[model samples]
Target: MEKDFKEYITPPVMLVVLLLAISLIFVFPVLNMIILGAILAYGIRPIARIIQSKLKFESISIILAMIAVLVPLILLIAYIVSVVSGVLTDFLASNPNFDINAVLTQASVYVPQLSPDNISTTIGDIAKYVANYLVGKIGSIANISLDLFILICSVFYFVKDGDKCYNFIKSFVPDDHIEFFDKTVESVENVLKSIFYGHFLTSVIIGIFGAIGYTLLGYPYGIFLGVITGILQLIPIFGPWPIYWALAINDAFNGNYPRVAVVLLFGFFLSWVDMYIRPAISSHHADIHPLILLVGFLAGPLVYGIVGFIVGPLILGITYVVLDSFRKELTESK
Candidate 1:
């Protein structure tokens, strides 16, 4: 009885406890940054290897690869920020009084609850609340900056020493479970590559087309709206419908019926493209189910925040693959 207790209960319990403690100590604090880094690392590793082969310096290749990934992202963010700022400034400058009363009066026709008498007080209170909330979020900027720094460092390390890191992780697994680990790793890489490349390329294509459509329709801030539409495309099911529909309503409100029709038709076309193109790209590469991708896309942002968009689907795919592998192994054994 003592020997059996030592062999089964004690060792397993101790291992579980140790793992829990270690994870709590190391993972909880930087989990988001780690996930972001891992995703970027996996995506950029091949490019880094290609550069390294030519340059003969691993560190230089990794840095160049990081730059290749980050430069366009930085430029896009800057452009979006400038567009938003200009739009806001123009609105405020044009409407010196910024008539909340007129807006509320118009809104009350639809909402039926917004009284013009209370509009001033209600808008004031809401504005104050928003300002306060934004101010509070400002405090987190430092933490976000720190996380970004950590992400860059982690990505560099991952690209530079990915093999060493893999081997180190592999050492922790039991010999009997090594094959499981290897299979999981392969499946994860395939899923991530499919998701990152396939989905991103599709979004970019839709965004460019949406931008062209909006521009042709003489929409204000068309580029900004197009970029937003592209970003929204990352969210499965939701896609760019919300933005396009809102634009259509705006056009209808302004008595631009023809433009509204164009917007609606263009939006529907984009939706169709998404439904068809996304699956073809993802399936051609990873062969993952559309439902799995959808769940991951929706749940990732909800659970993990913005970065969760990528990591969420990835975790789901990995889990599915790992479970499928286990099922096959068990069946073979039986």
Candidate 2:
């Protein structure tokens, strides 16, 4: 009886230890990587598959596909990083002796209804009161570098092992449900592909028009601003309007009165394109309501950051299809 008790206890204890070891060694990192890699893979998997089918070369196809996809992304990220870094560096170099109180006092007096007589004295007093209010910039170079490295590594692993992943997931589904699951996943994949491709094409159109309009209007950094505006336009709801409006306001502030009208007109055109064109494109691609797509866009970012834009909508689409299928089945049976 003592031997039997010892044997059972040892097995249970060993099992617990093994489970703990597996959790520490395997579960945590994989879970984190899955979230990261799945998003990257979802975006690029179509292109990779196309390359495989058309090019008929496995390793070369994937490599070329990665280069085609990642090179522009890397370049874009570098450009943004450079621009942000330059801004930060300029700020650091300026080392401004900010007189916050004086500015506030002057600002208050400049307002339409404020007293003029109290302006200088108020400004001086406020300046003296808030002399120590200052902030220093923290450089983001290290963090950006680390993030880029992780993203690249994750993308590589994701592309390499994606098939294995599909098989692993497929293994879990019951035999009868397998086809349904496959079809659902395919539908989700198609939705994601459509959204991405449509958005990309629309952005290109907007970016080109923006570049031309801004350049014609003689705005500084028009091309850069246009590209930025175009990308921002991909965001749901708020979209590109804010950026163009901000640019227009900057022009007004800087006394470029003539260009302000042109800028405003440009923004309006872009907004029009977004309103009219995007919905049509989305409809063509997804066969879903534009309103629902908009909701997906809004919810996607909230749920999954950049990736959520595609993933969230795909999820909603799949669920809609599945529920509709069930509803049809029930009606038929009845």
Candidate 3:
């Protein structure tokens, strides 16, 4: 016991602690990018592996997989941002507060850099920064550069060496704690799937349905409205309700009472479907509480910027599962 205490306060350990603190201080700024990259790599790995199976070059496969996954995503998000900015610009001049109908008509959308989707995230506050960044109003090009570099590198490395990384971490675990560790890892995986299904996948499903419904109703930008609804769905607290309600309000103001009723009923259906769909998709997973994810979505951006939308929820989910795992282990022991 004396020897253990002596080692605990030893100079070498103290130095190690000091170095870790210093390293963390340096890492803290770019840490979110690294973390987000790992999260993205989780999805990218399988694609890379499948591509690799067809070709002998692992690096080429990973690159191709990355290009396949990221190029469309980049193009889609770029279009959304470009379209939203154009709408905001054109409408802000006519209506200082910005016209909602203009937004519905002209804007395309969703997610991180972005979101409020992609695990992606935000629409409510997306305008605040996205417009600025997209329009070349941002001051720190170097910071953006660093963030992209770290994100891409981290994704590539994580996809390539994730198993090795896991094994390395596992080596440090005590034998008695091995089972607990494994369970906790499994739980973490479940939590990721839960978020992916509960938020991301649900958002996609809702968006498609919203697009189809809005178009059928003959709204000018029906498809875009559906896309926006899907983004709202990603928000958890808000859903497809806002889009329909907005349209209903617009209809009511224009003396289109019958259409308002129709849209509202459609809105109700959108909200109603969510109840069944979100749970049904997430049923096979960890079933993380909504509060955790909500806090994550709202708070993540504050700490990690837009990427935090997904990161916040995921990190919180991991924490909850770990604690839950610990609780179960402690209970079983008693």
Candidate 4:
């Protein structure tokens, strides 16, 4: 009886528990990176495979597919850096000699009984403290560089041996729930594809209009601001609003009313794109509940910073899909 019980656990239950404990231990470092890497690989693999199938050259296909993914990212970063530098130079050149205290005093008009003097002093103090605190912060750039290097190493390994690693890891799941496990994976993939594709297309469309409008109006950082505004459009609600408002406020402070007016008009048009165009396009890929997506979006930054933006939603979507699958499976089995 004792031997039979031991053998029973050995066949599956013991293996399951052991794997679960290991997964829990390295969940963040290894599993998280692997999952992210797999999703990235999955997204591009089809294109690579298509090329290989047509040309019978797997190596060339892989190289082309990698270039397609990597080159745009490098260019995008370079563009951002260049634009930011230009904007900073432009801002410094424009000498706006306005009293910050006076602006605060004027703002207290609608909300009477507030002391503008105290408010101005407090604002000035906080601003000084913030500047000092930022100066005191050390080695953030170095830390970021190190993290990027680590991520690149992980990504390379993942792309190379991802399938074998995934299979080995996934093997721990009980045979009974294997189908459910597969469903969870598909759900995650679907969510990622939906988010990436929807955001990319929408941003491109917005960038086209934004750039054209900014260029015609002769905004100093037209191309830069346009691209930044379009990228920011990925965020919900107050997405493009920040860039538009920043440009407007910067122009206002510089006494450039014409520039402000042009940017404001551009902002209004962009809102229409965000409110109407995105939902229509995204629905075709995935019928995500706006509320759920909104919650995930807010939670994403809190939990995992930038990576969490996509990872959070993917996690939620997979959980929801897996639970649904389990329930359906149980019902049919019953």
Candidate 5:
């Protein structure tokens, strides 16, 4: 009985327990940042490797890759923020009084139960709620910064030592199970890459076209609305329709019937781009069901906030692969 109990506390078992504990500790606090870093590392690893091969230095390669990736992302974010700020400033300037009642009255035409008389109090309540929310978030700024720093450092290390990390993980699995594990990892990687490439590329294409269309039509904040439309493309089944339709409604209200028609036509075209582009890019790599991706995007943010968008789909994909693998194993056993 004593010998059996000692054997039960084997090295593998102990290591697994330690790993589980470490993962549990990180999951709630910094798992999202770590995951994001891992994803970035995976995406940029090829570039990093190529640079490493030429430069003969892993650190130099990682630094270059980080610069190459981060600089554009930073610029894009800055541009979007500036554009959005400009649009808000213009809106406030144009509507100097910024009457909540007038906006409510317009909306009440569609939502018949909306009382224009109560709009002022409703607006005040909403403003107070938003202010309180912002105040609450202010307390988390330091934590957010720390997470961001961790994320950056993790990405660098992951990119530099990803293969070693992968090997270390592989060491834990039995030799017989290693092949299956590798397949699962490969499948997950393909799914993630496909999702990133297909969705991002499609969004960019639609946004650029929408921006050009809006500019030609002399719409205010053409670039800003276009950028928003691009982000909205992340949501399945309702990509950019709300924004375009709202613009169309505004045009209709202004009696610009021709511009409304043009907006509708362009909007329809932009929406169709997803149907063509997403399948072409994503389906080639992984046969992920559209429904799975939809659920991941919709439920992910709900559960994990912003990080859920990526994490949600990933979890679902991994779950799918695991189930499928087990099914295969069962089938083979029979």
Candidate 6:
């Protein structure tokens, strides 16, 4: 043990370790995006391979796959954020024609504990905070642009050469531990599939269904509400409750009793659809517990911000399976 420690602590090895630490420190700020890019590459790599099989040019295939898959994904996220923020900002901005006082008065009738004046003041404070935050973020446009470029490049290269990276990492694993490494890799893949299909794919399906149902129900901002529902579906605990509940309550306040029952029924249906879709998609994969995902989704944003939504679940799932693999290995070795 002494001999091995001395060998590992040689001058050359010490230099390498020092440089590696510095490199990590340098990239610490945007490490979240870099890690997220690597996770996303797992999904994009398969598509790139399929296209390369037909195109015969690796680089072009990756670019095409990114355009097909990643671009739409980025656009979808941007659209949701921009549209929601814009709509809220516009609605909150004082306009002589719009009377928020009347709406709050009606709301107070149902929830007497909530005074109309207090609600109005709270909402005014929130609107001011959101407006100020948006204005402040505007100054960081360059940083956003830089992160976008890094994410794209990271995905592209990771897709094109992920095998090389995998092999490079595997080379460092001792022969006796190769089995453990392989099991961990398999676990990682399963986690990715579980998240991509169970969370994201299901979100898309629910969102589309919501848009259609709300439009049919004749809500004013039906499509917007549907998009919000779909986004809500990504959070395991939230599901579609907020959107449908708000609609139902609004209908009730307006004395539309029949429509209230109809919307509530539709909301329950959406919730039921989620129960079916998540298990059906996730079962064949890692079959991670809902509680694990719930914790990940809730805690991830606090740590990693927006990208945490994707990174949090994947990281937790991967970590869970990796530890499980290690436990099995330890038992078998005994």
For all predicted structures, in order, the TM-scores are 0.83, 0.64, 0.81, 0.71, 0.85, 0.85
Residue-wise lDDT of candidate 4 within 60-82, one digit each (tens)? 77667767888998998998998
Per-model lDDT: 0.86, 0.71, 0.85, 0.73, 0.85, 0.88
Q: What is the model-wide C-alpha lDDT for candidate 2?
A: 0.71
- Tens-digit lDDT string for candidate 3 (87-159): 7787778778754544443433521232213212345367757777776736777889999999999999999
lDDT of 6 by residue, 109-206 (tens): 98875667898678899999999989878988988888989998889889988889999999989999999999999989999999989888899899
lDDT of 2 at 246: 90
The deviation in Å at residue 268 for candidate 3 is 1.2
Q: What TM-score should be assigned to candidate 5?
A: 0.85
Ranking 3 against 6 by TM-score, winner: 6
* Count of clashing pairs, candidate 2: 0
| Top lDDT prediction, candidate number | 6
| Per-residue alpha-carbon lDDT of candidate 1 for residues 198-270, written as tens digits (9 for 90 to 100) | 8998999889888888888898878888899998897777789998999999989899999899889999999
Scored by lDDT, model 4 comes in at 0.73
lDDT of 3: 0.85
Judging by TM-score, tell me the better candidate of 3 and 5.
5
Global Cα lDDT for candidate 1: 0.86
Higher-lDDT candidate of 2 and 6: 6
Ranking the candidates on TM-score from highest down gives: 5, 6, 1, 3, 4, 2
Residue 208, candidate 3: Cα error in Å is: 0.4
lDDT of predicted model 5: 0.85
- Give the lDDT of residue 321 in candidate 6: 93
Backbone clash count, each prediction separately? 0, 0, 8, 0, 0, 0
Worst 10 residues of 3 by lDDT: 111-120
Clash pairs detected, candidate 5: none
